[model samples]
Target chain A: MLYTVLPLEEVLEGIEQEPGPTVQLTLGGITVEAEPLGNFQARVVRVLSTDPRHFLEPHCQPGFLIHGQIV
Target chain B: MFEQPEAEQLPEREAPGLQTIKELGQTVTPGGPLAEEMPFHCLTIIGQIEGHLVLPPRNKTTKYEHVIPQLVAIEQNPKIKGLLVVLNTVGGDIEAGLAIAEMLKTMTTPVVSLVLGGGHSIGAPIAVAADHSLISETATMTIHPIRLSGLVIGVPQTYEYLDKMQERVIRFIVQHSRIPEETLREMMFRTGELVRDVGTVLVGSEAVRAGLIDEVGGVGTALNRLSQLVAQREGGMH
Candidate 1:
């Protein structure tokens, strides 16, 4: 049950479609799901960790480029 | 919308401390990285707050389970002085958002929430949950009745269910913030503010005036306030 103010149509517009290519790997002691930018670099999709401080790291933020790929 | 600073501009700088690009953006040289040490943890609550079901991969989501554990970890870490919650959310699941808000409210650590873009619907509760709340000059917060976005349960009792859910959210906001219950109700049901919806849009200063958010400011102001709060807490501890 969605309680958001955003229109459901817009939120779920692509729910049925394919999500394209992505890779899930462990980086900096955290799990990172990213969209490959090739040449060994990737744009962060999400940084997963149980530690809240990890989210504070500018390097682990979503949308920031995570290169020096560690799988 | 903020840039990643000078280091991001040049590729060579990324590897100065990190021997390889894959060393996870950390500077591991013996001298230590030049980055300033932040006293508080910066936890971002953005995109959709995924509830019971996993949102499809196409949707950007903040899973409740992921956040709940992190909140617990922050509380357990004594070195972490405060928490900076950066919210730019459309407000997904009610239970999830409220749970996150409740966690922040109950924690002993000082928490500051800053609304950057749009903190709408369920986001309102989370925004006011902070020890201090701030909104960017142009950021907005929409207060409205919660709607069943996709399906209707098709029963007379459904309205009651939705009403009860709405009440819970409104109650939470009023309990956390300085907003009067009556004013909140009026803003929520007010018409003409949104073309397709019936509600009031409180932009930055409006939200501050309405007592929904504590101040009108951005990242720098928020960080400064967070530092002050951390100092206050430390003074009390000693």
Candidate 2:
């Protein structure tokens, strides 16, 4: 996948793509393929990596979902 | 024979078992009596910090969900004069670690962190999140680059995303600690420090020398420092 786990701020301020078959958002310095998971929330499916495990171990997979409502 | 029975004469509402249970709970968890009016609140960050995902039952984890609400409550509670963050973790989710660190950074109550055993990886940021940080003489810290363990798409953008996340951690550590960005980066990217990894391991005074930790001390020092901060804050208010 080519998705990145975006912070809540990035998701709220993400640049929306033009109307298309799939949702996309440019955030956290990368263009991510987004799927609406909830209200004001999305699941990024583009950036996938095993880097997050370095912090913890075993189960620290990179997250793609970003959820937060903008004020 | 004299007056009423001694046990009956005691308060009707209080139970003796309550004290035993409270003591047992305190022994199990770091925070003593959460409801009790105390001068400082203890927040212990142990095991892996489970962020958005849930870890296996065998793996001990600290859920950010729980910590976040406790932080909010600690901030809102007027009785909590200060916060004592005790860290003995190997790090966990980066975002979750950063989230906890950020909340501590912005909290109005004074926070003091004490690194007991090992504060590695993401735990580094949290250890330095407090106004004053302490690391035990035998404690060690590992500084390394952000790594991925699962399936990874080999592409330029992937590395870019990783670099951005790494920068966030570096920036936060540099801003809060006395270590310069260059020195911290060097420690992070240094090789041969670990048997099979590309990073540096600082033990005890080394962390203090590297400017990552404020002092080389333990619980006594951390508590004393927190007391001073709480007193200063209270004094300022007066």
Candidate 3:
């Protein structure tokens, strides 16, 4: 398998910094949509993969203990 | 005996002023505040999500500019514990809908979404963006490919652009919801589903079965889930 020698943070920085497609098309005063999907998808993938546990963790706060602790 | 506000009574006057503001806001927005100033805030995403372009006057729109700021406030507000997002939209401006969905997905506060009526087009992502999502038994969600209106130049690049945009929507929905990417793509590209459009409309339990929605429920279920989340958070803090 091929791998880059760069550190994980550096690799992530590289992906984050990569410029996306910049296309400009004007049709009858309506500028064509030009969203940077490639960069966004890459970022989302990184977020999902690196922190699967975090993403899966429920957003709600921990529940209260129903039973009282015996001192 | 009821005590009225006197010229010397400042607290009484202030209370009524605050109530007036809340009442006025309730009049303008679809969902209002729950009784007794509950920590959970309710946001209604109705009609079209208007972006840079102004939709027709007759159309009902949830202007992105307005919603974006409200989201920021909800995030910053210390008193707000959770969010309840109610969606009933035909969807509009792909980017705008995605932006809202992204904000909701990334929010630290627990969010529970309930889809009533229809969640079509870009509304699909918004519905699934919440931590827990529900749909009414009669609610329907339309999964369709991205489409452009007016002056279509038959070019390969346009199709490529559309595909990329559609891919973003599918990626977001699959990442947030239980639905798989392949199934969502199939629904988006499905044929003979709509007489005029090429897409599939999953209603209520069907959406849950397809894994697009978390469960089949209504307002009570959505509120109960959100309250539970809030309690869970409070439990965690202690």
| Per-model lDDT | 0.83, 0.73, 0.69
TM-scores for every candidate against the unseen true structure: 0.76, 0.67, 0.66
Q: Which of the two, 1 or 2, has more DockQ?
A: 1
- Model 2 clash pairs? A1-A46, A2-A46, A2-A47, A3-A46, A3-A47, A50-B148, A50-B149, A50-B150, A51-B147, A51-B148
Model 3 stretches with alpha carbons more than 4 Å out: A1-71, B1-36
For model 1, residues A1-71, the per-residue Cα lDDT tens digits are 78888788777875766555888877657776788887667877666665666755556666677666444
Task: Residues A1-71, candidate 2: write the lDDT tens digits.
Answer: 11122222332232243322346554433444555655555654333222321222111112345554312
Question: Which model, 1 or 3, shows the larger DockQ?
Answer: 1
Q: Write the per-residue lDDT of candidate 3 for residues A1-71, one digit (tens) a residue.
A: 00111122332333334444443322223222232233211111111112223322111101101111111
TM-score of 1: 0.76
What digit string (tens of lDDT, one per residue) describes model 3 on residues B48-75? Answer: 7777555544556677755665677677
Docking class of 2: incorrect
Please give me the DockQ of candidate 1 compared with the native complex.
0.51
Measured by TM-score, the strongest candidate is: 1
Off by over 4 Å in 2: A1-71, B1-36
Angstrom error at residue A71, model 3: 70
For model 3, the docking class works out as incorrect
Model 1 clash pairs? Answer: A68-B21, A68-B22, A69-B22
